[model samples]
Target chain A: MRNLIDILDLTTSEIDELVAVANDIIESPQKYAHKCAGKKLATLFFEPSTRTRLSFEAAMYELGGNVLGFSEAQSSSSAKGESVADTVKVVGYYADIIAMRHPKEGAPLVASMNAGIPVINAGDGGHNHPTQTLTDLLTINREKGRFDNLTVGFCGDLKFGRTVHSLIGALSRYKNVKFVLISPKELTLPEYIIKEVIEKNNIEFVETTNLEEVMGQLDILYMTRVQRERFFNEQDYIRLKDSYILTPEKLENAKEDMCILHPLPRVNEIAVAVDNDKRAKYFEQAKNGKYIRMALILKLLEVE
Target chain B: MTISPIENGIVLDHITAGKGMELYKALGLAELDCLVAVINNAYSIKMPGGRKDIIKIDAEIELNLDIIGYFDPGITVNVIKNGVNTKLPKIDPPKEIKNLIKCKNPRCITSVEQELPHIFKLTDSENKVYRCIYCESKAK
Candidate 1:
């Protein structure tokens, strides 16, 4: 009955419950294999995201559910000029649950309005991505053993990073959590977000361009790519790209137990050399993404 | 410009000055066979320094409710008769809004599809930002 369109739609308790369920599944994977035996998950991805699409498929598989739907708009009825609402309505009859990703923002919202099944927004343009927020929450819970009282540092493209915006909204609900926003001036978090979410919540947060300066103080370092195309001035992007790159030298000042994360398909933003570090949790984070999704699938299917 | 009071027409109130013309254009009032009196700078003794703008549209055709809601909610429409202000009912925004205005995000569901209703939730009236419920895209 619930739709996972935005992070705000999920209450603090619901997220806590999801995190708990995700952790339970992680602890005992064999116990939840047939949780969704006859259910089907339709992933209607208008845009291509290999990592996200694959994770959803893998999640459904692990939950003993079948996965259907397209990875791109070219493969779906959307190519035939079908409205999102109509596509979802037809798909809802065929599937028990729907996970949709479209280049258009609010595509899932449109789908949810018409679809009878529970709708999950996989990714929608440059807008909010709630499932990734769930993954991040599960990752933080798994690694740190708690979500409260942590100094999480977000580096690179905060302005256009939907995951960053969604995660910040999720974490703002936690206790004693402070955000250290590290990004280039051009790719800083949008003012509307800062004004609406951060300032309104009275959450402790700071904006700084110097990642090295604050590297030692963070409990979680989330690094995202800074693409050249996102820059209006090519020269500025070329200058700042290498500086945001996470190397062993950058981790020199970082906390011994600090965890580093990236919502994968990572370009050179994170040096592969840091993969061996004891604190590198991006790979584990990626795996946990599948597990949390498995938990989500099982929970949503049981509602019907 | 000087204009006499409409004998039988609708008077719009609380319209931010200079917005009447924009609404006029948006409504395409000129094309219609109606007497559209635009009071750009009218003397309002109620206001400080007694200066305000009022618009009087005298027409047989009824105003488009959605068009009014889309343009300005502050605008109050009153049906006038025999130099007396008659019933002035507020235009409530549609319970289920259909496409008319556009979402701020061009890559939103409302924008890409012609069939889907272009929906926006009025957020801050002072800022004039409508938050697209689907995408959370803010537009002025």
Candidate 2:
């Protein structure tokens, strides 16, 4: 009956529980391997994805469940003019749960409404990715050991970064969390998000074009890609692409304990040399994505 | 000149002037074969500049109050039965609306999946803001 359409769909307590379970899974991987012995997971990705789709597959496989469905829309019945509701209804018969990623923002929501089984939104356009938010939460928990009283700096593509928006939504639920939004004016966080989540929640936040000025104050630095696909003109994309590249020189000003995070497949936004830094937790964050997804699948399936 | 009072139908009163046609279209009034009266720029004692819109449907038809509230929450509804004003239902806008206002975001899934219904949820009641449930685009 439950679906992971948005990060807010899960309560703070539920998120904490997911993190707790994820931590346990990390510590004792074998103990919970075959929890969903006979369950099936359908990954209905309408768009091509490497990490998000694979993470879901790996999570389900580790849970002793089988995976089905398509990696692209062309491969699915969608190419034959099948509606999302119809596709979901048909898929619900074959799978115990569904993880769908679509180019359209609310396609998963449409599926969730019609699906008989629990639906997990792997990624829905740039609208929401709750599982990624959970993964980010787990990364923060593991790296920093706490959530409250932390200054999180969101750099680059704050406007179009769904992960940034999602993480900000999640982090705002905690106490004493301040946001340092670093981006060009064109890519600044959307006004509705500002009015709805930040200002409405009374969370302290500062907006600036300079990432270096606010680098030292941050406990968590969340980086996002300024997508080339989002731009109509190549000149604008090229001009603003290198605006906030996090290099060793920039990292020098940040706190030693400051955790660097990114929803990966990052382009030149992050310097290759900075990957060696202990603070860069994106790879580990990617790995943690599987565990949290495992925790999510198990929780949704109600498999003990 | 005063318009004749309705006897056995729903009276939608106090709609903002120049918005009655929109409400009529939204409510699919064009499909209605029954007698329907729309008084545009009607005199209003309470409103500033004494202007409002009044719709008198001369039949007892099922109306979705939530949709009415969303279209124009300031409007008042009066249910008339057998030449009598029977009840005035509370017109609070719904928190969640399914298959209604579409998400305006170009990147929204509904845009591609043309068969999908446009869904919205009332995110900010004070601001009277309804956002696309899919992409969270604020309704215009």
Best candidate according to DockQ: 2
Instruction: Compute DockQ for each candidate against the true complex.
Output: 0.78, 0.79
| Candidate 1 local lDDT, A80-191, one digit each (tens) | 9888988999999999999999998888988889999999989899897888888888999888988889999999999999999999998888889899999999999999
Q: Return the DockQ of model 2.
A: 0.79
Candidate 2 chain B weakest lDDT stretch, 10 residues: B96-105
**Collision pairs in model 1:** B99-B118
lDDT of each: 0.84, 0.89
Q: Write the per-residue lDDT of candidate 1 for residues B1-107, one digit (tens) a residue.
A: 45777778888776666677888776678887778877775666564456655667885467777777767665778888777787556765543334555666777
CA error at residue A251 for candidate 2, angstroms: 1.4
Candidate 2 residue-wise lDDT, A220-280, digit = tens: 9999877777777888888877778898998878999999999899888899899999999
Candidate 2 C-alpha RMSD relative to the actual structure: 2.2
Candidate 1: chain B TM-score equals: 0.71
Residue A298, model 1: Cα distance from true site in angstroms: 2.4
Q: How would you class the docking of model 2?
A: medium
- What docking tier does model 1 reach? medium
